[model samples]
Target: MTATSVARGATTEAAARIMARADELGAISSRADALERTHLTPEHRVAADLVGAWMREAGLTVHEDAAGNVCGRIEGLRPGLPAVLLGSHIDTVPDAGRYDGPLGVLLAIEVARGVRAGALPFALEVVAFSDEEGTRFASALSGSRALAGSWVEDWWSFADADGVTLADAFTAYGLDPGRVADAARRPGSVLAYLEAHIEQGPHLEDADLPLAVVSSIAGARRFALTVTGHAGHAGGTPYERRRDALVGAAELVLEVERVGRSSGVVATVGQLQAFPGGVNVVPGRVELSLDLRAEDDASRDAAWDRIRTAAERIAAARSLRFDAAETYRADAVACAPWLQDAVRTGAQGAGVADPPVLWSRAGHDAMVVAGLAPVGMLFVRNGNGGVSHSPDEIVTEADVAVALDAFAATVAQLARRLEPGDTSTAATDEDRAPEAGA
Candidate 1:
């Protein structure tokens, strides 16, 4: 057989292994009926252990950090050289699909397995971040942030639905809160960070493309809004006399959608609750969540301004009081142009002459990693119209085969750029922007 045919056979074989490993991890969930492996939970440790074992099998030196992130490293041309970081989170959203995060990880291991000793200029490290979904906490990206050295002391106070503090969770998982910073990689220690994830949006599927080079990750801001008004008997209160908070909140929700559409942002009201529930009583208060995202911070914040103004008007007109508390905020992250080119070249090497570039509207662990090093992403097309965070999420073995080939090529492309006297690997001002999508 020709060399090209042999490579194709190998790619197909590795893709099959990745799919099988995804099934193994999928079976390790906190629930019997659904998938859930959150930060610092028992499931997280189990998943980390499994990934560590795979890394070891790939000839990597493995360890679990203080924050519970599983890391495996293979030396490059020489020991202790800066490394090219690969892989993705192992944790999942509640009821998440098997391929969303684990595919990238398993693929990274496959790439590491293919590397020959002393062939590259830098180390190869794969990380199975312990938490990216925040399924059991108020904030997400704990594992990546800890690795990026962006951990906030306040995060220790965050609690789960069971009222377990993040600090306590760390202790329960055999991690030390005092040593969390030890997970952080020192400045200049990483060459770049790359992640492969299933495209959570329909753009790739709609375009009929198997992969794309991600351009930027959207900035996101989340808020908890409370609308307050006087409660009264539903039967006794006339429409003219009613000061219904729920009604105001409903109007605000619709307004958010309208503003988001016009402002070119994505806004969602994922949760809403009415207080003092009674069958015969008007809702005195309503609490709702607002998630706003856009390609950049300025646009996202502009949309939020419009939404806040509209919300004020709705509250005033309805004789209700409105208040909004900012809960989570992430600035937009732009992928490095050179890294994008590397991904584009990688796709070309995989047989695509022109890989489309896309902006990601979803948040990802790569966004946090960008704080540490230049970051880029390769998006694998998702089947079922790009459904994710749900059981319906899918990726064909054909796509996985192509993704593996492209991913390995991207790393090879990086290695070439990192050769002696190759300044293309040098950081630029554009590298300051963060990147990737979930």
Candidate 2:
């Protein structure tokens, strides 16, 4: 076989293996009809075990941390040198796509497989964080926060939909809640973190690009709002006498979209409910969820203020009561410039001389890890108009092939930068850890 054809065949074979593995992991879901794996559940354990097996085959020492993060490591020049970490979460949202988390993880294992012992200046570690979606518990990034030494004690009291507290769930899953602190990595121990993930948006697909370098992860805040009004018989409630909560909430939802667009942020009301459902009675109370995200925290907070002001107006005009409580918040995280250069170099080696850069609106484990180490990300183009978190999420084998090659190249580029006496971007204060909440 000619050199070009042989190279093409190898890429195809590697890509096929990654695709096959994604299929296998996708089948181990908690739901019968769709994919639904959550933190510290039976399915999580099964998936972690399978991933650990793959890590072993890749020639790494593997273990499960106290927080239930599956980890594998191969030493570099020496046993205890500070290491470069590569990984993504394995948790999933309800009805999630297989590629969202699993693809990054499987690719990490593949990259490690290609790295021989003592190959770089720093050791290489791959972690499959146990939770990033917050699907089972009220809190997200449990595994990564633990790794970053940012574990919040309050999260232990957080519970799942079935009323199982995180502490109890840990016990049930064969982990000690107190020992979870051991999962934290000491500062200066991790050189940097790298992740490869699907874009989860249409940016790359619109540009017709197979890959891009991530600029930053957007800050996000979530809220639960309640609107209240008087309920009355449908026939008895005259148009002029009506105080409909649903109507008021519908208006507020439109206001959310309007303010979000004007402020250049993404606001979504994914869930809305009306109480006292009856054909003869009007809805008296409504509850809805608001997810707000922006490239910066200040912008996100400002957008929320505008949204709140709009809600107040709608409630007053409709003669209803509106109240909102912040449910969760995470500050935005910017990727390190040096790491971004490495990612770009990697993509350029994979054929794109000028890869596009995008800010991630979706959260990832890297967001939490940023608190501990310099972080960077590579985004693979998600097909079907970049649809994600659904069964329709699609990624072609060709894209995966390019992603693997680019990801491996990224590791190599970082290695070169880390070589002795290379001060161009060599671990400076610019790469200082972001705040824990970052």
Find the candidate with the highest lDDT and give its number.
2
Q: In TM-score terms, which candidate is top?
A: 1
- Candidate 2 is scored at a TM of 0.93
List the global CA lDDT of all models: 0.86, 0.88
| TM-score for each model | 0.94, 0.93
**Compared with the true structure, what per-residue lDDT tens digits does model 1 show for residues 155-239?**
8898999999999988988989999999999989988899999998898899998999999888999999999998999999999
Q: Deviation in angstroms for 298 in model 2?
A: 2.0
Residue pairs in candidate 2 whose N, alpha carbon or C atoms collide under 3 angstroms: none
**Candidate 2 ranges with C-alpha deviation above 4 Å:** 1-10, 161-163, 424-426, 436-438
Report model 1's TM-score to 2 decimal places: 0.94
Candidate 1 accuracy as lDDT: 0.86
User: Where does candidate 1 stray beyond 4 Å?
Assistant: 1-10, 434-438
